[model samples]
Target: MNDDLKQAAGISFIEQTTLDRATIRTAYRPDYGAAPAYKSYPDAAVLELPRAAWQLSEARIINLLQRRRSLRTFAETPVSLHQLAFVLWASQGVTALAGNHLLRTAPSAGALYPIETYVSLQRVEGQASGIYHFDTRAFQLRLVVEGDQGSGLAAAFLGQQFLGQASFCLVWTAVSRRSMGKYGDRGVRYLLLDAGHICQNALLAAEAVNLGSCPAAAFYDRELNDLLGIDGYEEIALYGAAFGAKQETTTPLAGR
Candidate 1:
C-alpha cells in the first residue's frame, strides 16, 4: 500500500523541471591541492589537543549527541577554513580502502553515491563568500557561484532570517540517474534517506568542532536549484543545513 501511494504521489512530487532548461554552464574547476594535507596520523598542534585526547569512544559520541542542538542564531565571528574542511570531510569524506569507492558518514542506495554537496559560504575567515561544490572524491571545493551570494540563500530558504546570518549553508542535491538506474521508482526514497544521513553527519560534525548548525528542510526548491545552477528535475536539491558560531546556548540536539 505504501509503495502504491509513493508511485501515485511520485508523478506529482518527484518529477521536476527538465535539466537542459535549468542548468547554467560555467568554467568551474575544483581545487584539490589547496586543502591542507594530512600526514596519516593526527597532529597534536593542528587539532589543538593532546594525542590521547583525540581518541573517540561510545561515551564521547553520546556526549556529543547530548550536546547537539539546532542552533539558529550565529555570532558574526568567522569560521576558519580548517573548520570548514573538517566538517566537509566528516559529512562525506571518503573512507573505504578497497575498490577506491568513496564512503560517506551516511549510507547510500547500493553505495551509488547519488548525493552532491553544494556550499554557500558567507563568513569563513580564509574563504570567499560564494557557492562551492564539495568534490568529496578529492576532498576539495570547486568554485561555483562567485561573490557574496549569501542573499541568494534567503531566496532558497523562502526568506528565512536564520539563513541570512549563517556563516555557510550546505545544499544536498541528487544525481537521479545514479540511483534510478538501480532502484527504478524506489530510487527516490533512497535519495531522500541518503540526504538525511549526510545532513545528520554534518550536524554532529559541527558540534564536534565547536560550531553549531541546523537542517532546513523547508525551502523554495526552484530558487535553490536556480542559484546553484542545478536543473530541478535531473539534479535536484534534496535538503539544506546552516552552520556558524552559536549566538547563545540552547537545548542540545533538540531539533534533530
Candidate 2:
C-alpha cells in the first residue's frame, strides 16, 4: 500500500498545482483574450425537453436540505422527461445571457462554464436508453450514442453496479482551457469547484423532485472519457450522480 502511494502520485500533482501568493508572484501570466467557443454536436439528433412541465414539490428549502440523503438504491420505474429536464435546469439550464456568456442555475467563476453535462440513461419516459448531451444553449438533448450505457459506465466505475440501476446518471466533464485561458493556473482550480456547484444543485434538485440521488466519483478516468467520446486531455469527466425513483434506505436527520 505504501509503495502504491509513491511521492509522484495524485497528491503530489495536486500540491504542485495549488496556487499561492509566492507562486503567482513568479509564475502567473494570463492571456485574457482567449475564450472558449460554445460546445455542440451538429450531427447528433436532438430532442427538445418539456421544461417546467413537472413542478418541484411544495417542499420548503429547509425540508429539502434536511431530507437530502445519498440514496444508494433505486426502483426500476423510469424517470419522466419532465423530471430530467428540471434536474438539468437546476444544474446547468441557462437562465439568461450576458454579453457572450450564458448565466446558469449554478454560479461559475468568471462566468466561464467549463463544465459540460451528459446523461447515461437506463430507462426514461419518452426517450430511448442511450448517451445524450444536454445542450444548454438550445435547452435540447443531443443523442451521442444510441442505446443503454449504464452497464459500460458501471464497468468503468469498477463494478459499482448501483449506477446501472438508476433511471439515469448525469456525468459532468470539464473543459479546463475555458477557465485556464482567463485565470491561468487558478482557473484549473475553478474547474473542479464549478463541478461541485453544479452537482450540488443536481442533488438538491433530485430531492425536490422526490427522486433517489447519489453522487458518483470512483471511475477509471480514461475509460469514462472514452465513453463520453472526448479526449482525456481536452475534456475529462469530473463528477457524476445517479437519480431515479426512490428505493431509499436512509434514516431521518440525526438528533435534530
Candidate 3:
C-alpha cells in the first residue's frame, strides 16, 4: 500500500483501540460535574403535543427492516400534527419512569441519553413554520425560533435541496458532558452510537406511517449549530434526517 494510504488506515486503528482501565479512569475525568440529562426552555412558547397512541402498524418488523431505505424525495402533502407526534414518540418518547430517571424509546449508553432532538417545522398542519425543541420529558415542542426556516435550513445542511422540500427535519445534538462523566473520552463514541439508534427509530417510524425519510450527516457544523441556537462546545449537532409524505411513485413499504 502507498505511504498515504497506510497512514490513513493506521489512524483508524489508533482511534478504535481500547484504552487501559486505569488510564481511562484517571486521565479522562473532567473537573466539572456532568450536564443534566434533559434540557428545558422556560420562556419559549410551548406547544403541547398530542398523546401518541401506541397503535400497532400492520407492517411486520422484518418487512419494515428489509424495506427501510434512504428516501430524499417528498410529496407536497402537509404532514398532520398527529403524524409528527408519532414520529417524535417513536424517536424519543418516554416509555417509563423510575424515581426521577426516565426511559425512552431508544437505548443509550449508561442511560445518559446525551442526544437531544430538535425539529425544523416547515409544512406541518396547525403548526407555524419555525424551529422547535422537542421537550421529551413533557412531550411538547418549545419554540426556539419562529417563522419559516426551511430555505435557510437547507442551506445550513450543505445545500441539500431535498431538505427544503420535506415537511420537517429532525436535528439531533449531543451534550457531551452527559456521557463524559461516566465514560470520559469514550463518551463521544457512545454519543454517536446513541444518535444512530435514535435516527433509526425515526426512519422505521416514518416508514410505518407511510412517510419517507432520509438520514443526513453532510452539513456545515458551525452553521447548523448556530442556527439551532446551541453552543457548539457543550452541545453540538451530530445527526439529522428529513421526513414527509412520499410521492405517488414511491411504493408503500409497510406491506412489503
Which regions of candidate 3 deviate over 4 angstroms? Answer: 1-59, 250-256
lDDT of 2 by residue, 6-106 (tens): 24233234434433333445875565786668888889999999744545563377667889999878887888999998999999989988999889999
Lowest summed lDDT window (length 10), candidate 1:
16-25
Cα deviation at 171, candidate 3, in Å, is 0.3
Task: Name every residue pair that clashes in candidate 1.
Answer: 68-252, 68-253, 69-253
**Backbone clashes (count) for model 2:** 0
Off by over 4 Å in 1: 1-11, 15-56, 248-256
Q: Quick one: best TM-score, which candidate?
A: 1
Tens digits of per-residue lDDT for model 1, 1-256? 1234334333235543222223424424346566556656655545555435544556778777989999888989999888888889888998775575665667787989899998889999978889999999788898988987777787667677788789998999998767866787678788889998899989998999899898997666777788989776567788898999877546568677
Clashes of each: 3, 0, 0
Consecutive 10-residue window with the lowest summed lDDT within model 2:
1-10
How well is each residue in 129-235 modelled by candidate 3, as lDDT tens digits? 99999999999999999998889888887789889889999999988778865776677788889999999999999888888999998776667888998765567
lDDT of 1 at 41: 60
True-structure RMSD, every candidate: 15.5, 16.0, 16.5
TM-score of every candidate: 0.76, 0.74, 0.74
Q: Which of the numbered candidates is closest to the native, going by highest lDDT?
A: 3
Model 2 residue 228 CA deviation in Å: 0.5
